[model samples]
Target: MKTPETLLLNQEQIKSLITMKEVVEIVDRTSKDLGVGKTINPTKVLLDLGETAAYPPYSGFMNAMPAYIGWEDSAGIKWAGGFLGERKALGFPYITAMILLIDPKLGFFRAAMDGAYITNMRTGAQTASALKYLVNKKKIKLGLYGAGMQGHTQTEAISVLFDIDELRVYDVNRQASEKFAQDMKDVVKGKIIIADKPEDAAQGDVIVCVTQSKDKFLKNEWIKPGTVVFPMGSYQECDDEFILSADKIIVDCIGQVLHRGALRGLVEEKKLSEKNITCTIGEMAAGLKEERIQKNERILCLPIGTGAMDVAVATAVYNKAVEKSIGVKFAFV
Candidate 1:
């Protein structure tokens, strides 16, 4: 008898197997499942490595995220790391990761694949799902802060879900903003404009912040009523006033949002509490909680990037790869 094999897929192979539309669909379904108590996603575990006194100022950390989707009987874990101020020296990405898929019934390892792409796309897809429920407008003016990898995917996912008349992008690096605008013009029909400041981008119909800044750049005054804001960059990009002023705040996970999500600072500052959050995006998607009831209401969504998304997307990708015979198979046991 032949030994069972595991599929190994690289970044390009994973990209070829998955699409933005498919990501949105799977993430949306996972969120709905979460609302109805049909999934198991544990709180992410982190190990913080403080910066050293090196010439390049090296700082490092690692994290492990695990999840199980009950509807699909799929499970997996994603192990990722970040090395700030050292990517150029190391000739690698600032962030890197891999996902390991498991057979839920047999508890056997089934596949392993690159996770960086999955992380970005799933984060964007989750935001896109939030928009479907939180933003009532069919046509919107999209604003993006930090036009990099995450920004590109967020724009891609949102464009697939909404009709954007215009896209305003802002980055600390003017060249990056120009490059982003030029790159995205072919993908989305909306006119892309480079903004001079983060405030300019915050005033759009749908505002997404994907920067790595530790300081708050988005102010309460910059956000207009009837706008849907996604603070996906954790608590780093949004000010306390901006978070407190929202009519409704929805999070991907209540446990994570309270501890590490966009509201973490507000929660620690004693300005906001758990009661302030209206509901999770899961609840809204499952019809357990109310959505945007008024056009003039300002709604905010903070998704901390759940492992359920990773597992779901990975499972889908693995199944597709198997069907298309796109990845290498190696003996596992």
Candidate 2:
């Protein structure tokens, strides 16, 4: 019985489509099933914009990802493609994306969504999940660098699993830093202090660098011992010393890392081998391995971005939406 599926939900209906709780559950379940791995082929495709000033240098790029996700009992190929880079200059956004959900059985179009939040939160929450296991359970402060796209919600995601005493925020864009601090104070329920320099913010129990800097804005010396640093914004910024110095290099999926994530740069630089990666965060969460070996140490957690997570969140949201008939059913399939 291959009946046409004509369910079409608009942004208004899907705006509150995903939640933090759903995102965490996706991380937990995905960890249980896949054990933190994905098949990723990374590449850069150029674009042609028939306009002047060229708002964004790149547009219409695609990342091909085919994944075997366990918890969902579904295998999928979710494509991350769009004209995102140019959106920012048009006063829109930096990343504009859509998640294609397939019906593992029939190979039908189940749903497509604005994956902006899905991409941001899942990656951020994966870092938070690593922190939940890696960071010492001491009530300490947090420092966030480049408090934009991925930084703001990361604060909230970390708060869900741990208690943060205070937050220090820094960004080259002063307004972003100030706004992030104010918002964090209200939401994180902790004191928010703005940092004057990158070094100032790095001095914390946990330091998260979520910037767009191509260079190493965060110096290795600035990293304190036993600090959990998440330099998720750019690749290779942490450098050889930082990689070698980190007692533990935890990642969401080593496959993605090696393919083209944080660890790829380390490997290209000959700083790390396959064995150098301490372990996937899933192993620690699942009790297959341990985290934070000693009190005086530093660890790095990086999640490149996984479709299994996107599917996990989309599944949860879809289920809830179906329960209440929240989405609109269409006649055209």
Candidate 3:
């Protein structure tokens, strides 16, 4: 098959092409497919992502996660992660990533789209889908950790799906936290507060953690018995206590989480047992598991993050860009 024109869609174009509803729908279906046992290989792409005083000015790396769909997707689209930066960087994003949809027949590349916005939306959308399956929509007091892109993205989706009236947020950088509060206040028309500590925000009806801190954000005591905790921040964001305390635990993929995700810390320390974990967010989202159980059940949702999400979101962007002719077309034979 001849390769079609390679469209280059920038961030703005991609942004206009998608809406929260579409993303939500994609997430719902993707989660269900995942729950039904779809195989997606999401390879960990890492480059020394840490600010170093040494050579290369700012020594860092951009991790690229490439994922290929198997069984569920006959399109053979492979999505990858885009991140550029190192830890403790002054003003550089840790990851500068993108996704490439390929034609499996001849290994032809279909499209290359902006990844920063793509990554944030997919991750946030995944979390929201988890909330749909794990949290009580009636109770919507949300506490968010880290006022970064991921923080706002998650909040944006949450505001639409749940009747979230108030969001309590905190960040090491006071400005980032304050900015997030103000910006989200503008976007959601909901109540917003700046938190002094992670614990202060813990009591929210739905607490979403989005920081990149290595240290644990919330204590087990901080986690309410019946609250929904969505940890979207650190790779190992939650403390053992909070992780272990949840009546039900959900991951995007146990294989992914066990390797380098929010649950790795607990899994490594032996604080959380394998039996304590119930299902992946996709599995729960897929309807394989009943959505939001008894009010008192402790539900913790950790979107292990998957390639299917990237492919789904990217596909959305690609179709939109094509429809609007927003992207540049490239021809490479």
Candidate 4:
């Protein structure tokens, strides 16, 4: 037998092979597969790389996220790293990583590709998938925090779903928010307003927080009735009360949510648990569980990112790359 070849793809190659609309559809399909138990997706495993001789104090961390999707016959692990302090100085994004795809049947490494583009696009697409099943409104006012890459993609993905009358953008760095508004001016059909305060961004029909802050900045009272809040960060961007007091709470994975993100602290405090979770977003999308029983019900969506999502999207990108004869392929022992 000949040695198997593994494909190597860069960020630019992957970027050329996928789009947000395609990713949203892929996420929708993958969520259903996940919901019906056709996938194996575990909670993220974290590695805290604390201060080292060469790195600064409280330097950075990495997460190992692995999963398998039976329907697509895809398997992979995403090694996601976050080194904001060092990366900023190096002029790199805070989070950077790669995805490794395996031949599920043979258990051979098949491909290694840039994951940052996939991460940003899929994160936004995941939110869009959740909104597809959770929201009923045709138009909305969106309040967004963390005017960064995530903020830009979230708006892009959401703009595909509803008519936005206004997009309220907020960031602790005033320049970032202003830049976001200016950058998105032509892309976003709705008027973009840079909010002076986090609270100012909170008063909206749909609220999304994607900041890097570990501190709880979003107040519970700022959230209105009949709103859906998507907290897309790894830590508590919103107050614990915001999650505990919501009418419904859905996540990418119950185990993952409990282990990290907005729900972790609450779980540790015994204020929340698996029982408090209404269902996975996959369940809602798959129609296995009901969503949005009442318009006035406040819903919280915590999607910390999933390997299943990565595998599914990555698989698509890989297939496209192969069909179009993109990327470099070479044997590795």
Highest TM-score against the true fold, candidate: 4
Poorest 10 consecutive residues of model 4 by lDDT?
A: 49-58
Task: Give the poorly placed runs of model 3, Cα more than 4 Å off.
Answer: 42-64, 68-90, 271-273, 291-293
Better of 1 and 3 by TM-score: 1
lDDT of 1 by residue, 1-333 (tens): 454689999999999999999999999999999999999989888666643224434576567989999878999999975666657487776568899999888777889999999998998899888888876777778988988888999988988898778998999999989989888888768698899967778767888998877788888888888888888874458777878788988888888888775787778888888899889989988889878737788888888889999999999999999999899998878
Candidate 4 TM-score versus the reference = 0.96
Ranking by lDDT: 4, 1, 3, 2
True lDDT of residue 113, candidate 1: 95
What is the Å distance of residue 113 in model 4 from its true position? 0.3
Deviation in Å, model 2, residue 103 alpha carbon: 2.1
Model 1 accuracy (lDDT, Cα): 0.85
TM-score of 1: 0.94
Model 2: lDDT equals 0.68
Among the numbered candidates, top lDDT falls to 4
Candidate 2 structure, TM-score to reference: 0.87
After superposition, the stretches of candidate 4 with alpha carbons farther than 4 Å from their true spots are: 51-58
Cα lDDT tens digits, model 3, 72-123, are 3523233333233444345656445677877656667778877777778877
